[model samples]
Target: MDKFVTRSRAPVEEQEVELGNLPADPGLRIPISDYHPNLKDKVRRAYLQKGACQPSHNFKKRKIENLLRRFNLNWFNEYKLWLEYSVEKEAAFCLYCYLFKSDNKQSGDAFVKEGFDAWNKKERLDLHVGGPNSGHNQARRKCEDLMKQNQHIDVTLNRHSEQIKNEYRIRLGASVDCLRFLLRQGIALRGHDESDGSINQGNFLEILKFLAAHNKEIDGVVGKNAPGNLKISSPDIQHDIVNASAVETLNYIIHDLGDDLFAILIDESRDISVKEQMIVILRYVDKRGHVIERFIGIAHVPNTNAASLKVCIDSLFAKHGLSISRIRGQGYDGASNMRGEFNGLKSLIMRENESAHYIHCFAHQLQLTLVAIAKNNVHVGSLFNMIANLVNVVGASCKRRDILRDRQAIHIYEALAIGELASGHGLNQETTLKRAGDTRWGSHYGTLLSLINMFESVIDVLDTIVDDGPSSEQRAEASALLEFVQSFDFVYSLHLMKNVLGITNELSISLQRKDQDIVNAMKLVKLSKLRIQMLRDDGWDDLLAEVSMFCEKFNIICPNMEDNFQMKGRSRRKVHQVTNIHYYKVEFFYGVLDMQLQELNTRFNESNMELLLCMSCLSPNDAFAAFDKKKLIRLAQFYPNDFSSVELMMLGNQLGTYIFDMRSDNEFLILNGIAVLAEKLVQTKKDMVYPLIYLLIKLALILPVSTASVERAFSAMKIVKSRLRNRMGDQLLNDSLVTYIEKAVFDGVLNESIIQRFQHMKNRRGQL
Candidate 1:
């Protein structure tokens, strides 16, 4: 016999099988045609007895009991099957046993000869009629036989499925090995057309296309619905392959990284549909001590707040088995919600572990500083506002916007015609000009400069628009725009500010460049600083004079130049350093000597010596006090003045009602002394005060305590994750984004307990 197994079958130990563990047994080796050996013979005999029906002769008649005895089985009329005789079923098994009969025992009556074999038609007719078995019983047996045949088919199918699974595993392994081989050979996995010098069955393009259309790679168009010519691999399956590959790559990297304190750079953003997402990046030391930055993943948060963001970050760390405590640094945009000391995301994280220090994102901080300076000064702010309005008026209308765009294109072409190419040495192509309203800032300087360089066409277009019968608002807007365009300040200031920002950008790149490059950049920074100082020394007074003249020419009031100083401010601590010592002088000159001292003397002590000294310095020329008080009074009498405003009315009334007493005065001085004492008390609490101040400055100046950081993060996210998966779920998207921001620390890295806690939560959820 050509049997495949059990040549030397050892008596198998019938041990109890554990759950998820398969039972060990020698597989059955039943013959193909004789799975039920006697059944075939009985059917053949019955057919012969029905006899001579197919020109073959044989005949037999047997009782159901005799048939059962022949088959070594017992008859159960209730079951309609002759069950195999077993000692286990010897008692009360008629009705009960029939209901629970095994597949082998679930059968009907056996076939028997209906007539004797003869060479006559009568004998055949008699064969058709039942001998021992009824016609219904024979039909039932046929149905049972068919069911047995189907069961055999199912067994074969299951065996084939196992074989397919084994084959698939082999193929997957081979594919992975091939990919690794290519990576080792320095061959990138990018796709190329056949015309690009290579063609292959293993090409990602070919595999992907093939799988997408047919689902399976083998046997073209396996189903009727399958396309005749399909392309692209199955996306779902491809994603699985990619996911597994990514995990494997990550595992290898983790193993190589070993135990080293690492920082993470994390940033979160939203896609077009406004889904909040995050990206994580790793800054870690490799085995060779090289600082490496590898993109880890992108993730999603439920919301763009610090708390929600922290949870997403925490989950990512736990999933990756990271320790957050070891994180040594953090870098994020200036968002108050992100960096706030009291209940901000950074504060919450620091509370758990102190080592994860927060650092202002240098680039972001510089941008905020520039913005603040621009907004704080009235002249500078007005210039930007005018520029912004100009962009808005020009770009608001589709027709005008098109004209501008066309003008830009023509200018670009002309420049190219003149043998000028976009250069990388400095600023090249500018961003497109975008419209801004009265409240908005103008186009970025880079964009404006590019537009100016391409000015000929733009000027022509503007002339055409002006010549047309424009609306009154448009005409007035256009005239104001033309005035700004012609102004020397407008032209010079644009270039000047652009140059300043350019230096800052250069400094940023220089600081991060290669060693030699960084050294050269540092030299450039020094030169730039000198240039800035020279501008301040030489041009500040001139600029201020010009600003005053401009304001006078426009009949606009010059905004108050007075500065306020508070002695209790933490900036006092910084004044101890020589470089910073000038701050105290500035405070005294702008604050104490400017307004407060004179006011204090008039209100409290009329003959105060400190007040007189401060007033003398405040106006050496006495130009302010020399202003005709009677003329100011006459002007106030003639028209509405700020001094007569409702605010002063309340203050004057309050002053009239005040009762000044020596005890009250003494108490006020004592309060001042107490405030001084408070400062003294805090000197020794450096651990608390210094860090708190550091955090406060960082939050107030370096970061915005607004949702702007989260907003910016989402804006970046829109670029990274688009319509392809605009609606990715929170958890999946969050995982994907962890790599983008490059969070400085993995929160779980610092605490084992936290990670375990996370794992426990995950397990509990999985059970549900």
Candidate 2:
């Protein structure tokens, strides 16, 4: 309550004194000016309540020029209220002057800053309490006024403004309600026209109007009824409220993080206005042991170079009171500027803290691996290029698209009449050919499936274009695409990639999930590799038979499997002779599958695989079936600072006991993962009993598995900084994003807290 009201006294004019904790020795006491301005009055009251620090000790005698002189404790009786003695300095001081001394030079200075100790001069004490207007008398008057609490300036100012404060609260609450709605929805507040006569002012002002019209209390103190200068609806005031909300949300995130180690996931992209903004997310296990990833901030950098990014990250950490040494992991894309071995952002962070392990984003790596291996093969590359041309030529306009749909409808109805195709609730739906994205490998699978379903319809559209042409160029292009679609190489590559991407598609989607853990994700990786390896070893005959069946159904000639195969554009006399089995099965079929397998193995190598396998040992799945004491001990060795040699020896013993205790206990049986096990340990008070094991759990959770959280923030950036609001300043952009992304934290923030924060930011016209 006291913090809500502004202080009336200047900081330099007030003094602080702690009563129960006051220093009895005047020599060790601090100056009153050194205390915080808000606590000054409390300090003064504390000292007055204790009533001075006069300790009655036996007087010690000192010989001066053969004459014995000793300080008399009887002087306390003469000046009982102000006189005090210090055992440390053997000094007598005036308590009133010590607490309320002025800044000007005064004759009673010896009683305050210097701690008076001249006991031989018996008359000097009388002279210190000079006249009524003396410094001693003035200090005495101040002490008396301080003891009367009502005489304080802050109380007097606050008492007269009771009604105004209530009105301000109502007004501020209304403004905050509007702000919360607009921010949570990521809607822009300002409009193109915002004059009074305009139909729609904006989201902020219009929402405030709607709110005021319904709530009588808000209507009384807002808009025209409120004081002109105190209106809280201006653009600057709105920005202040937004800034406060962002600060509060960020504070909550940091507080929830506590002193726990955390990993950082960072990524950068251009906004609508072409500004390069970097979004940072923190991944850590919370008190409930849930893996929480919070979007902390977005920084606008001059460029995306590694050194500039490091500087920006360092500044952000310093501003938030976070230390670089607490970083245990870093996740980023596979760009050279991000994950390069030297001079990259990850490398720079690793140089400072060796424990901050770098992990390339698994999802992005899979995409790059698939795209790289596909382009490396000649037949697959030509097949994809032909697919792209087929989609463009067949579905170039509405007329061609209608033809495609009609022809496909005929094929579907004819097949259903003969029972060649099965009918169901969602079968035979219309779909157009899709273009495969360079960065999205799953889209290629969809494109191939669409091509297979509409193969006859695509050929019909191309034949129509050849007969009734838009021009000669269009006719020639459609004729050439028609020939390629009817060839064996095109049909074979289409089916080959369709089967291959189908295997990896499930793994790609699994890696992008927010709840994915390193152990499960690595397992999915291994399984995908196995499936691809099996396809390479035993899938050639099945693939060739499927292609042959498709060619026969479409009237395309299937080459004899035992005949000598020649290159497409070369003569058999000049080219190397090879059987169809050697060319199709040995060269093309094995080539693509081998490339995919090699890429997967190279990208996800054995060393990191071993680390993830060791981490999997901590999983609580199947009632702690995966728990291995030796592997857990080895995991602890990765973080040397967290566990020393002595702690490691104790940890080995603790792990042996921990596994048995967990397996025997009924409470631990319901736990599913290491995260849940962490929370249960805290709930049962075992975290304290087995402290080293809990520490290891925290360290394991700090290792990041994906950068999906950062990617989600970039998705939010598109909504918050759309083209219409492209010119928004960087500070406003960052503030709005923080509140928008962490709405749960913002919703818990009280409206009064935002008002207090807004008031403290500067001198507001309204008294809040």
Candidate 3:
């Protein structure tokens, strides 16, 4: 009886038994041993309560040696208690042996397993009831003992054991609940001192204590009352919970992905421990037609070479039940190993799947374009170098920074009092000089804007440094920066680049958006080119006027436009005589803008343009006004695997009806983007009506415009594996980050599922 049930079971009275629902036919009923371990006892007791299933109906007859013989209902009188009949099988079964027979014992063979219906064999029943040591007699004794449940000692011990199992469940559930909260919020679970009596025993323990304090049942079983080995609060247990949560989260993501094709956005960076880790994001259209980007995993790579990354990617895909052929797009940075011609990751994948188009991250490309064009010009390059030195000189020390802030405040107050500056909440806020970074051109634009606003304060700080003489080198540096700030060329270059960056900044930001499509992105690119060209053509006079005004305000001399242009550090007589207008307008303004336009053109070239244009033909904007039959057909030809020659021809016919049907409907008239159009199609069930067009839409959405999602995963990696947690192992880091980054998806995973996953991970001291 002690090992009768291997799993926890309910108390006898609490167990439910619906006799009307039980199967009376022995052949159709589930075997007692086949029930869940926890339900075996309950099933046995239910069957005993219902008694035998002998029917009084007429029995079917069989011919045995020219004599008619049939099952006799009167046999129930001879084998009174144990005989049961199966209406479905028309056989007699032994009730005692069926209920109490051990899985390995087979003493009453025909009666237990095959069912006996031999009406002429009267002595077989007597023989089956053999001796006291026989399997059938032993099963009968056990059955008889089970029916006498009035034993006080056995009942009390069973109830107590059941209570212990219930308490163990509550204790483990509380631990899992705490871990879920911590994991969702990306909070670290452990502390340096998690020992008892420590005030901060970590998020896990403290949260568990807080939960127990509010619930009487949890309070009763958690601390002193719980078994020492089953407390479930150790670091290993926390890791188990965390790992379970991550696995469940990944499962949910993959389930949402379904069988749809997805693009992989990958990027690699070194963590706080200098470990090279690559993060992957899956971009796919969900069932609802929303373009979703989910961070799947991060892998530790020994090196960032092409072959190593390829192996790592293949392993990750295999581990997740993902296929390499399903990848329709690959997005990476401008590194050679990622996009190299012969041996790159993209090329390798392309050899397997030619349609997996490789696209460099648009945001990174724009940054490079800005950096290349700006440095290519001598004036703009020197201007930036001076700006960097000026910011460093002014904000180098706390004393200098303080002076700059105080001076800016004074200037703002004076200007407000004199009505020269407007005062508003969020206007004229305290800001310091931003140092530009080499990798991010956006930072340079930010630095320029901040310098323009804090120009006077910066000059005041430098002037103070020059006069205070902290050191001769510092003073000389300060003096040199001060001279550069006062020159007409410096101010002109600063304003000129600011205007150029201002135009491209909007496009850069637009391309980085997760929802941006290739059509609108290309349109923005063309628009940016036009604006920069306009600036080159007609912006010279306005720019000159603004720079001159800035110079005049700062008490710097402004040169007359009609005067002869003079090169700095060169004699006026030795310099070529050129009007100041020609030098400032042509040599400087037009030159820099032309270089920017050329870089933009070179980066977003003819091939990229053609591809994007064809994709744009599928846009739902203007009621599918941009839709073209030829271009969309061409788009389908790009993914030959998705659409064959026959489907392509069918698609051409479907497009004719698809566009006409969409245009005629009011609901589709207001559709704005490809994503919205896709969702509308699904809602109206038009996706089924035009399967080919919908496939093309999914392909367009799968073509990633930027690697922003992967970049964000790297950002989360830094936070999860910071300097303090630098020693975290690879598996732990990967688990923590997946749950942290994809919290939205993780939140949908139930706590029960995570507990079950954890329990099934391995045997635990307590059942969850």
Candidate 4:
């Protein structure tokens, strides 16, 4: 290194000695003469030639690096580094080519064509090969070779990301478009089927899975061994997008319908996997005064406590900018948590906003009342228990089950051959038996009816078991079962439930029908109440008669004979129609009555008169809280369990005060007036104002009570983003949903400002 450096060092003016003219003194024997002008020029040329040419392209740098490695030359290391700088710059360009420039077919063609030429004409350029052609050709040939070796692999890494976006676009696009079409066409959800192929075609849940898990590879979706070539995004991003989208969409729907109160219907049930979910539905009046019910969402809750449920409800509302102050009423089943006057959900909501009154689900209340009445009747209850036990026994063993199945098949075939549809065939489908809870037992009537329809199969199975299988004890039990099935109690209860079920079912149909007349609707509701009352009366009478007959048959205590002895003193609370009645019997009868009424109120719709009368009868002088002036006046008349003209006049005066103070422009005033009108109806029994007014109040509460409006939007979002494309930028996903929802206009009120507010809030929060 010193010899070469000394020879190539530029000549200093003081040192003009050539190699042959060196001084003799060892200290002065400087080899500066070797650094003469001609020798220096020669050294420079040698260095340049030996180090190798630095190419201007990335491919060439790689090519040179390979060649250098093969030769194991460290001398050209500095020169090689300079080439690396050029390689880096070109590498950026190559990346650009892979992203947006290179065509795979063309890249391959370049390899097939230029590669052969470069290989066949390979030559090291002479020292004079300083022309641009020499360096450019080397770089170009290197690029061609590199492209040939890796045709599409360079772009494959980004494929998954691209595919995810595309999938999101397609799914979201389909969902939005389908929803818009349906909304415009006014199609119901159940009837909203696509023309050529149904959009939801079993993939509806799959799409929801994507949104729920939010771009994540949720369990049960894709297997762990998914190929590297397959590109599916995690559903986490999708979930977030859908959640936000759902809220936005719901807001838009709410905004579109102005000055209209909505009604909320919430029902809670455990799903197949025992996950408790509350389904929220909204009912509102269109311009035509017709009611429309739209399912908003199904929300999973930790528990069904009123406080927790209310919190869930409130959070949903706040998210969508709905104010609870606008709520007018609440509808819930007769579950204690939902309807308990002290700490129930309705009471909690009412505490926040006084108008959010609760109504037991009319249908559910009717069902409850029927079940109670059936249970209170000893004959009916026992009959049902026997049938239920028989079903359990037969259904318990596969052999018995098979026997029942075979009997059913035989019955059906026989009926078909005789050209008659069996009146009691087709019983092998899924059935929802009435479930018992804290307040009430199962509907004995429904169970009785179910058993009767399956009686043939049940009897055949029991006969087989008694004749062909099991021990003597089993035979004896089977004999008892046969006796129970044949008992008059069983036959009577079976006919009773069938008739009651028919009535209840018809009542349900009337309530659910959109075009049923208001008068007819009220009549049906009223008749349902009467049916329950009549059943309760019949249950007691039948129980007494049947029990007495059974006692006589079994040689047990004669209930009828005991009833012949009457108590001298009765409870003071009893209306003394006859002092001969037994105190225990009156208490027992009243107990049964109260239980039946409570159950009936929960299971079916009841007339206002029946409801109030029952309440009056139970708590004749019980104090009811009166917050509003109208309620106070209304309560004043019913102070002693009956309405009076003086109280009606007082209520009228209260309404006058409310109306006098209410603003003409306030839409809420219209609703307030309706509430006053409802108060009047309780006295007048006009019935006209009650149904419509109740409906109006229901609508008002549902709209602003909870943010269930956001539910549909989320469903739409899930439809838009599925497993195939889950990852989407949050902003983009939100934008797509907002646009879809804000299509409807309300008195020229556009949602642009609202959307902007949402975005601005999001941006500000993101920075923080």
**RMSD (CA, Å), each prediction:** 30.4, 13.3, 15.9, 28.1
Candidate topping TM-score: 3
Q: Which candidate do you rate higher for lDDT, 1 or 3?
A: 3
For candidate 4, write residues 534-561 as lDDT tens digits.
Answer: 7656655655565455445434343233
Can you rank all candidates by TM-score, best first?
A: 3, 2, 4, 1
Q: Candidate 1 or 4, higher TM-score?
A: 4
User: What C-alpha lDDT values do all the predictions have?
Assistant: 0.38, 0.79, 0.79, 0.42
Checking candidate 2 for backbone clashes, the offending pairs are 17-43
Record all residue pairs in model 3 with backbone atoms less than 3 Å apart, i.e. clashing: none
Q: Return the TM-score for each candidate structure.
A: 0.44, 0.75, 0.77, 0.45
Q: For model 3, how does the per-residue alpha-carbon lDDT over 184-294 read when each residue is reduced to its tens digit? A: 677788888888788878888989989999999999999777787778889988887888788789878877886579899998989999989989899999888888899
Regions of model 3 farther than 4 Å from truth: 1-160, 439-441, 569-577
* Each prediction's number of clashing residue pairs: 65, 1, 0, 38
In angstroms, the error of model 1 at 401 is 4.8
- Candidate number of the best lDDT: 3
Model 4: CA > 4 A from native: 1-249, 256-259, 271-276, 397-399, 412-447, 468-479, 512-522, 529-768
Task: Give the clash total for candidate 4.
Answer: 38
* Residue 122 lDDT, candidate 4, scale 0-100: 24
User: Whole-model lDDT for model 4 versus the true structure?
Assistant: 0.42
